[model samples]
Target chain A: MISVTALTVSRGERLLFRDLSFHVASGEAVALTGANGAGKTSLLRTLAGFIRPDAGTVTFSAADPAEARAGHLHWLGHLDGLKTGRRAREELAFQARWAGADADGIAAAVDVLALEPLLDLEVRKLSAGQRRRLAFARVIAAPRPLWLLDEPFAPLDARWRAALGLMMQAHLDKGGAILAAVHDPLPVAARALDIGAGR
Target chain B: MILFRRELALAWSGGGGPLLACGFFLCLTVLIPLAAGGDPAGLRPIAGGVAWLALALSSILSLERLFERDLEDGALDLIALGPAPLELVVLAKAKAQWLAVGVPLALTAPVAAITLGLPPAQAPLVLLSALVGSLGFALTGALGAALALGSKRGGLLIAVVVLPLFIPPVVFGAGALERATNGLDPAPALAFLAAWVLFAAVVTPFAGAAAIRNAQG
Candidate 1:
């Protein structure tokens, strides 16, 4: 299970979220809904160990989030963050290698994302939707137990969104958990945690 | 080792700026002799200095790419999440930069030496000292690269930050070559270069890694 207890996140003297507590057990999908500047991404970053909370702790049962990063959690942020000048295959290979995923795992991910035709193309040249798809494909490439995605569907088209829904379902079915921040309604049945402005 | 190999691959692919810097190094080496009238005696005295300056300039040119792309594309976050400590990641990156830019420059020192009319006996020592000294340059440059990752005019910013740090290597490398030409052993100069490399190998990575984390925060 992934848990955030009594978390208080602040940015430069302003508290974004105070005493925020939450948990997503295995096979659960949790959506973070919030107004503009409601600290959704900050909350996600804190959970992913990318940002330290002003107070409280984020715990991963299997291991400390910092120590077992590859095994325990995966974070897909607002930026598609693809290496701009690299071909899709090279990017996938590099990311998979960094995540400790195997060659077979990478191949399977490419096949699942239907990126065979685009595999040889440079990422910078790909459209935004294609880039998002490629970023989404990384989740499949390295199957971590917990996923924290910021705006996973922002740049995806309807078809890709549906495909991503299925992917999320598959992940949840396999005993993985997801915490995603989204403005649009997700295809999956997810519990919504709303963060309004000044709350 | 795998991380180092990945960095090497990224640099060697030349899609980034390192390849252009190599070309710049080559061009500068050839241009200086032509501009200086090809006076072998005068050129011989300053060959190591000229080469060291060229290496430093080219290195500064390529330093921005060290962490900029990764920071922009989110690879920096992923790397921070890797099992290897961030310090190791910085070291690996510095090593890769050295291999791509420094090692190539060192290997081709003979060409620069010949162009500058350096004595044959001094060429090897100049190359060896440069190889050692460039390791320090790469490490120190990486720290500046990390600090300037998201800054405006990042390339210029790194140069501004790293040029002052280049003094020690420039002095030692040039001094070693000068001593070699005078028929005196340059053991002290070479030892100083080695010491600088060792010191950077230990500490610069921590500074770089801290800078990266701070930038991300």
Candidate 2:
């Protein structure tokens, strides 16, 4: 659904990547493999429209890139974006609503993530893995066409990693696309795009 | 609506939001009498000006973390991807700050004026000017906070960027109180203050949204 053509991104004086071109069609998952500081996250941020590329263009199939970034994609970055002072339920509800998800969608996400028992506790009290699951719940609650994940399974336990793999499979089966930045192999099969090799 | 509610709740729950500003304002009012020698005649004439100054400074107190917290915690990224335009999101944040902290500071302005020797009869003018002036502060403060995002010394950077923007509102607010103290019409100055606030309200969203986008990049 999205294509990048000769994309070049730089951070201050250093160039992260240059002349990089790739595409992800519907019902596909592409794993972005790279060494540290190899521009995987930068590429994701650029696609999500947070960072403007130094050169070249990234064009989407149907919607304008900006609109697509705003409405059609889910970006799960390193940070959970949960406020420590807020209850877990409040965070989830706010995120779900902010993403335009209905109450039924939130309930289904909660069920899939097994978030019921942890709903009442404050976010600060939850462990990192729980917080990560809570963060992932936002994606499930809101059905976006594209998923831009940065090390999506980094904080999850083995069981959750497997569960999240199933979710990704289901998402791809339903005509969704995924571009995940990762060091290890993804649980589900994906085309490996080696950013480090692109250098 | 959800964003506004979330910001309001966050402001009240942690970091002593409104209370901190009011306490600083009261402290400034109390210190003026102590520093300027406790004579009513001397303090009375300058009470409104001093109160306005304190209000402006107090408004700066809670602003350092306005957008910085969101940026640091990665909420800004999610916010960027939300359905609302970035300009509206910035406006919502400033509105939330106004409701959460500015309103309480406005409420405390009159008390601070009276403490600084302003006549109780003129307290309503102090309250009115402060209400409008604080809104201006919140808007300009959001711009400042957004601009100062990702900087090393964010708090100081916000004050440096915001205090200059605070000048016009301070002048208008203080002038309104000064006119009332002299028994002339205070409406003109209050109108000017409101107009300035409206201008800030209009400009801050666009400018602050740009700053937020830059910071995110």
Candidate 3:
């Protein structure tokens, strides 16, 4: 579903990676592992089109660039991007509508993530793990063809992490692809791409 | 459509934005007379100018929060990847803010003029000219907020960036009221103020979106 060639990413005067290449096909998952400050997040961001590469092209073979960016991919970053003043349910529903999800999709995501109990609580009042769970639910709420997760497992307990692994496996079972930046191993089988090796 | 409503709800979530801007205008109007030694005759000639200046300054109060909060909280990244063009997103945010904050300042301009000792006969012109003028200020202020998105001192930077852009509208809006009070034709000045707003409405979105992209990078 995605491909890149000779990708070079730099931060200011420092070079993070050079001459990098990788691909993720449907029903596949690519685990990105590297040392701290090894540009895993930067690479995910580059693929998500948030940062322009120093040199290379990111091609989504089946769709135009704009369409691929608009609804085809789902991104989970560190901040969760949630409003503290709103309830968990309100936040999830807004994201669902924004991503073109219907009622059943939202319901299934809530059920899978076990978020029904915390839906009425405002984001500010939720614990860190609960917030992380809610953020992941946003992705499940509107299942995109491609998922770009930057450090998706942080702040979760063992059970939630295992649940996330199961969720990722189910997504792959449904022919979805995932590219995740992580320090720990992913739950499903994935081809590991170590960014620090070539440097 | 969801984003627009979301912006409006966010703006009013804390409380009513218009109520505070209106209160700010009232306090500013009352201050001008005291600053001028409480002479009614002395305050009349510059009442329109004082009212326009207050409106311009008050509009800046809410602008620094426009894109800064979203940028800090990671919302900008998801918003950038959304289906709508970034320019439309920027426009929706600015328009929602104007409805929440700018309209009340304009609605209360005539009261400020009255507090500053302007004759009641010219109240309608004061209100109309200020209405169009504040929209111009809101558009420019949105652009300025985007430009200063991640700066260390974004609030001060916004004030510096937008105050210069506000000069033409302030001159035209204050001039329209000045002409009406002097019993001269106010059409040309009011027309100029409206023209400035129309121009700003067209150009601000592109510039604001570009600034947002730059800040995100």
Candidate 4:
């Protein structure tokens, strides 16, 4: 379970969000919604341990939802985080190896993502949508139980969107938790946590 | 090990820069004697300096790519969060850079020396000194690369940050070559180069890793 309590985040002299509290229990899917510049990405980044809040704390608890798991959260941001000048297959393999995923898991991720045909193509040569797919595949391949996805549906087509929704459902069925920031409505029964009013 | 291997593979697959740098080294080594005109003795005396300068130049050519693209794509952040410690990641990256740029230059030094009219016996010492010196170059370059990752003009920024650090290696490497070619013991210069490499190996990774972290943040 991920619990964020009395969180206050600021960039420079401006406060992006304050007094923000939320809990995503095991198997729960929570969508972060806000207008432009409403701190949705900041909230996700803070949850993923990539950003530090100006006040309060974010905790990941197995029981009380007030503890932190230093290594169990996976973050997939908007940039896609791909290494350029490398073939798609090689990049995936490298990421998997670095993440300590076994060979079988790597192969399964490639197959599920339908990345076979583009395996030998360098990442710089791949389309933006394809790069996003590759980044999504990396998240799926990670063994982390908590996922923080920022703009997860950006370049995905309708077919990929449905597939991703089903994938998230499967992940939730396995007792995993998700915190995603999306502009579009997610095709899941997730409680919306709007960050506009800093509630 | 995986990170090191991946870095190596990436450097190997990147085209143009690595090859052109090696070619430049070779061509420069050959051109020195031709330009000096009909004086084999003069060529021999300057072979060590020419070879070291060529190696340094080749290394600079490849340094710009070290962390630039990875930082842009967010791979550097992922690597920092991976299982390996940041220091080890920096070391692995330095090793890859050396393999791509330094190793090739070292391997071809003997051929370059031949063109420069350097004696066969002095060739190995020149190559060995270059290899050691280039390790330091790679480490220092990696730090500069990390520091310049997000700058507006990264290429020029890296060159500005790194050129000063190149002095110690260039001096010792060329000095070692000069001593070797002149039949004098090259131990002191070689020792200095080795010590520089050891010092760089110990300290450069931390600086590079910290720079990467700051850039990511």
User: Which candidate achieves the best DockQ against the true structure?
Assistant: 2
Residue-level lDDT tens digits of model 2 in A1-199: 9999999999999899889999999999999998999999999999999999999899888699888877899999998789998999999998888887899999999999999999999999999999999999989999998999999999999999999999999999999999999998898879999998876
User: Candidate 3: interface RMSD in Å?
Assistant: 1.1
Q: List model 2 lDDT by residue over B1-217, tens digit each.
A: 8988998998888799899999999999898889998887888888899999999999999898788888988888998899999999999999999999999999999999998888999988888888889999999999999999999999999999999999999898999989988999999998999999999999999999999989999
DockQ for each candidate? 0.52, 0.82, 0.72, 0.51
> What are the Cα lDDT values of the candidates?
0.82, 0.92, 0.88, 0.80
lDDT at residue A42 of model 2 (Cα atoms): 92
Give a tens-digit lDDT track for model 1, residues B1-217: 7678777877877565556777888899988988888777778778878888887787777788899888887888777776688898998999899988888777666667656777776777867887888788899899889889789899888988999989888888888887887888999989998888888888888899888877777
Candidate 4 interface RMSD (Å): 2.3
Q: Please state the CAPRI-style docking class of candidate 3.
A: medium
Q: Provide the TM-score of the second chain in candidate 4.
A: 0.91
Better of 2 and 3 by lDDT: 2
Best by lDDT: 2
The superposed Cα distance between candidate 2 and the true structure at residue B52, in angstroms, equals 0.2
- Give the C-alpha lDDT of model 4: 0.80
Pairs that collide, model 1: A81-B73
Itemize residue pairs with steric clashes in candidate 2: none
Best by TM-score: 2
Query: Candidate 2: where is the Cα deviation over 4 Å?
Result: none
Off by over 4 Å in 1: B14-18, B30-44
